[model samples]
Target: MSHVYQELNPGPFERKASMMITTNLSVLINDVLKGAATLLNQNWAITAAVNVFIIFFTVFLYLNTSTTSDQVTIRSASNNAFSGGNTTTLKEIVFHPNYGGLWKDDLALIKLATPANFSEGVKSISIAKSLPKQGTNAVVVGWGPKSYFSTTDGILREAVVPVMNYETCKQKYYPIFLFTDTSFCTAKDNVGPCPHDFGDPLVYKNKVIGIFSGSFDCGSTTYPAVYADVTQYNKWINKVIKS
Candidate 1:
């Protein structure tokens, strides 16, 4: 399989309008590739909702807010299978007001159509209040393919990746690409998320600090995997959940 990282154009990072798309993952990916960012304003919603038991491609980080029935979901387990877990429909989606272009503020809040009942297997995860220190070990969880050439195995997996310094990561993507302060990098290694791993969470000390955004080449040592730093958007998250 060929993994391509498309370069995004810099535009006004302002909240302009909102649009709704289907809940189909493949369709969403295609739209995103076709520059759906231009149509998606500050908040975008999906036509169909997702189950709370499994994570979908557009959501990550389940927040336990008492004000709303909608909760964020991450991409995990089989994308089309729900053999052993419960499922729920998504009610609404709220993307960051400043989200612009691909991998920039690549964060969103999913409101389930129905509230999820907390149980032993289903629970809310807290967002990171601060960024993790460089070299800290963080776990990336998803059901994406293990390698670029392999297909998705439908089994949820986790890999520990060390956080890379922003300066060091900046140098790696210098000239070709530039990451904003809202983003962070994980050291390049054989272990990292591949295609279909978008929206997966990167957790440090049980707090979600990152959301898998993009990678030049899956698991490429030359290019570290990038994530949207959740610490930079805690206030935005709270505001969305409460609104």
Candidate 2:
């Protein structure tokens, strides 16, 4: 939906794709009931406390795990950006730990670079091969909650959106892409990133290059904020991938 007169919204960065580990709510509840034993002191208060603890723990574990799907950075373009780097797959995303609804993978080897600005909105990138290998910075082609969830009471969900050069996106997407030095852009060709494909990758160079972070479909393309780009930090990728 690239257009003029309307603000731009160059979604977020791109990268290799990865699957996150999900949780089983039913199994979690069952675990609590199954472990409600052994501590049979007859003390009603103690018994109740024990059960409560188990339930809390199980729910916490289950909830935390739902967002474990690995999100590998994917390469979109096949130009000279990166012609001879590692070709990652969907299975490899699990190697990283999924916690707090954040893809905190290899801080060094893999990373979600600080956000950057493009034009109307912001941008972000996720790193696949750390600095030196590809570069120093990476992308975070993110999706879902623009901000982190304040309450961890439910399952973690992801979002899917588009990305474009901040300035370019602003011209065609929305004005939201114009934020600060910490944002960029991305989205689908017709409808931008949706809620289902949140945190998907936007492949770039030999390794994952950018991230699909944020977006706001406010009927009009004015306020759009997405993940930043990290190609600028390719130096970071080269330094960390080998070590």
Candidate 3:
């Protein structure tokens, strides 16, 4: 909903139209559920089957929705941002063995003590198995500072960044640190990730393909921001998921 509002910058009539559509959809779904419930008393067998089917269907829908939102909110180890405090805890951080100098293999799988509750606002995001073709448009979201020297007020901002070809990125970043083939780049003059956006997911078509690594300098129009390619670490990610 927020994404639509921000991306479209909808007018009053458009907003009203959207609200009507949403309200109608909600009413239709509720009516269906209520009708299903009405079957409970008359036919126990049918009701049992209906209940089972609904459970499974809802689960599948949630998995897909949550998968596209894997990086919902960022929280500190201690829940200083909330009054009730977050129940989730970081269980482990698995970094690539070769992750060092120039932040190569700058990928890590964070395990939670308990899985996050997948609902209307919180969910998981799917990770991409294949790299995005060069020039693909990707969405970058973060709660980072607006600029290199600014401070974050905890507002989430998003940008559409275009993927750059490797040779071009390599040429631009040469002499600093050659980006491993396992890394990728994105940039547009004054339109890219900032310093505090490190570790944020870079999503393409609702799948996370890379993570913000670093840039020659934040907000650099000349130097594109680099990201650790998630496609190259699928095996490691799967291993961690299984573990």
Task: Report the candidate with higher lDDT, 1 versus 2.
Answer: 1
Compared with the true structure, all predictions reach lDDT values of 0.51, 0.27, 0.48
C-alpha TM-scores of all predictions: 0.67, 0.31, 0.64
Per-residue lDDT of 1-243 in model 1, one digit per residue for the tens? 012111133321111111111111211221121001101112222111111112343334343333232333221112232223444434665666666556767766665544544442334566779887898888765545656776653434456678986677878887866467778888645667676566656778876777777778786658888888878877877676667
* C-alpha RMSD by candidate, in order: 13.1, 18.1, 16.0
Rank the candidate models, highest lDDT first: 1, 3, 2
Off by over 4 Å in 1: 1-82
List model 3 lDDT by residue over 1-243, tens digit each: 111112235441111111111001000021122101000011110111122233334434644654321222223211112212133333344556676545567655544445544332233455688877788888765544556676543334456778876667877877777467788888766566664456555677767777777776654548888877777777876665665
Which pairs clash inside model 1? 17-41, 49-90, 50-88, 50-90, 51-88, 55-74, 70-111, 70-112, 91-113
Candidate 3 minimal-lDDT segment of 10 residues = 34-43
Candidate 2 per-residue lDDT over residues 1-243, each given as its tens digit: 111101123443232222211100011132111111100011100011222233434545655655331222221111111222112211211111212222112111221121111221212233434222222222222222222321111122223333445455556543323333333554433333333223333344433434333345511245443433444434543443333
